[model samples]
Target: MRNNLISGLIFSFFLGMSWLTKADLYDATLAYQNEEFTLAFSKFSRLAQLGNADAMYNLGVMYLYGQGTEQSAANAFAWFSLAKEFGIAEAFQTAQLVLQQSNDQSGLKDFLKLQKSRLSNTYLLDSTLTKLKQHSTTPTLSKTHDVLPEYPDEAVRQGIEGWVWLEFDIDQSGKATNIEVIDSYPRHVFTASLLNAVEKWRYTGSKQAHTLIYHFATHKDEQYRETLAIQKKAYEKQLRQNIDAAERGVAQVQYYIANWLSMKEYNAYQLLRYHWRSDEPMNELYLAAAKNGLDLAQYRLATQLINAGAHQLGVLWLEHAAQTMDIAKYRLATVLLNTGEPQDVPHALQVLIEASNNGHLRATLLLVNTYLTRLSDKAQAKAWLRHGLIIDPEHPELLLLLARLAENQAEAKKLASQALKSASQRNWSSHAIHLFLQKLAN
Candidate 1:
């Protein structure tokens, strides 16, 4: 009788302990979601000490962001590395981002070396580390092997010498297409010729599609010849006019002036809203500043809206900031691809291609999605997957997509199995991937 009573008490004690453990995790998630970083950090730290991988990851994020603690990239990296040991893919990516942001290339090299030594038994880690090593050594710009085109006679005569910023798509076969001159000097003399020449440039075939930018600069003397003093004055006048047009209203003008003064989006939004009604035309000013071309305003507005739980609006502003034909476009495309609507998919693909062409790591993942789902071009899809693997051999999304393709061919059930394991490792929330894996298991 005493033994039975003791067993019941022991079972109850364990059950209560398990419930408390689950409650603490739930509370930590809620606190994190609510931006109560201090509370979340406290809970997560305890959980992490108890050997919870997810808690370790959450704590890493808190440290990375300086939430409830001083920002410490080193600590963030340490926790993320620990999480990676338990196969948290997001932690691995976060560690890479933290290293990049800190400009700690030496640390990144050391981390990779450590990973290579300690996790040599793990195939995924070994493969990923190998690709990272190879990428670290590769040059950003590839040498052009195609025949060079002669400079346009008109451009030469006009002495056009500044760089012509050209944007184009490079396919899997290394063929450049959809060439467009984004910005250029002596538009009439150089734009068309620059576009034409870039379109004809050939590359060695790559498994992944990338965007490439070629800068064509004329000689210094030629640049002077291209410059027209009066024309330059007129261009400056036009730019001021456009700026004025962008800030036409008193409220709008005030917002800009305040933003310039304070560099705070929330303050600008508050001032603008205080002076103008929500339904008024002046609201367009905020939207334009958020989306049209201003990146700082867009980022600020997006951050504010996200904090306020206006996810859709926040996403729209972030998309605008990300799509501004700038470096941040890659970051914006990543967020958009994760949260935006179906219409955002193609735009995300375009930004991903641009970023990938520029050698951005986050953009590579999007390239896989672009080919597989956005482009819906099977051959291109296969090519991009192969290319992504070159950069990140164990990328879960790439593996999952390839597995789905193989399932269609009925040639490799083993790929499907491996893909399921990879997807699970990454915590991918795709219903289709899940259903396919279930079918393969059956």
Candidate 2:
């Protein structure tokens, strides 16, 4: 019996050794790290479909970098989620980062819920187990041996299809514990489904907290995928055209593209500030465009400079742009207002008055607020508002301001009602006006 046991152990050891190595997977990983992304992507994708966790993780990275496929945050997220479940140790962290870069938390949550729903508890692939068995450091799903939930009868009866967010903790023993709901529309319906599934879900790793989504639906989620594909293709084509036009100096394209690049940089600041490096400087584009006397470019450059604390240079740009652009004059007034002197106030107010006279509603509103606060001048506020009313009488915000100036309570109420009704009908309620109306109501 002892000799037979020893022989069995030796056979298992040889089997494990044979199963562990894959020349194609190793080559793919090497290529990925060496920045031969296209070649790496092909190999990794092929292996990922074979249920290789490492290949799945690499595929996620490739998608994130736009190496072989179109740069798709959604695809990256999906691949990483698969990798994480299949026992890739670092895939979870990478997936979270990919989602953050996508800049759509609500949409991502929905996507994840749908993904979770599509995954079957009974669906353990032999290939995934083979890959996972080779990496002992990687965590395994807790072998709790639980059943996957069936489609709820109530869900079908009322045509109810939605998602629920669930939070759970993996304990020191690699068991999923303390499951609870975070958010769900029509809460009680999906709670049982989540709780029952989680009861048998386990993880074999260090303690970790996770929030997952479970979405219910009647049909395949092909519509959203199709829409995203169309948008991505359109954006890419437009981007290439814009880049060509900007480089060739095709009329207003230079300034327009420069301004767009500036906005992109601003949006990316938080994400790229710490570690992500970029050689593309939108400042050079802005400078070139401003030198060519692009009024919009000058204004944007001035705003950028002011934000970076270069006040004197920014003011010059603002002043130059303000010579032709009414909006620039309004923005110049805003910059001048921070100069900390009584003389600056008069000049700023004058610039604002000019902009307001030129049909800038925001400038007019700012003038109204300033006049009402500084000089307590009801006449000036009325005059400023009248200019906007001439342009657009049914402008809900201006109507709301007029209500604030009403002589009697009944007049105020009538004006307020008119503005609210108009705003509701038109979907044009600005946050500033909304807050002001709320305050006046209180």
Candidates in order: C-alpha RMSD to true structure: 23.0, 26.3
Report the alpha-carbon TM-score of model 1 versus the true structure. 0.28
Tens digit of lDDT per residue, candidate 2, span 275-376? 223344444455445544456656665655554555665676777678777767766876666566767878888888888778776567667877777668
Q: Residue 436 CA error for candidate 1 (Å)?
A: 2.0
Residue 188 C-alpha lDDT in model 2: 81
Which residue pairs come into collision in candidate 2? 142-202, 142-203
lDDT digits (tens) for residues 301-415 of candidate 1: 4544544455554555555556544444654676667674788777777777776666554566566666666567778777767776776676555667778777454554566
The stretch of ten residues in a row with the least summed lDDT in candidate 1 is 124-133
For each candidate in the order shown, give its overall lDDT on alpha carbons.
Answer: 0.52, 0.58
Lowest lDDT sum, 10 consecutive residues, model 2, at 121-130
Tell me the spans in candidate 1 whose CA falls farther than 4 Å from its real position: 1-300, 306-347, 359-362, 407-411, 423-434
Q: Can you list the residue pairs that collide in candidate 1?
A: 159-222, 161-218, 207-383, 322-329
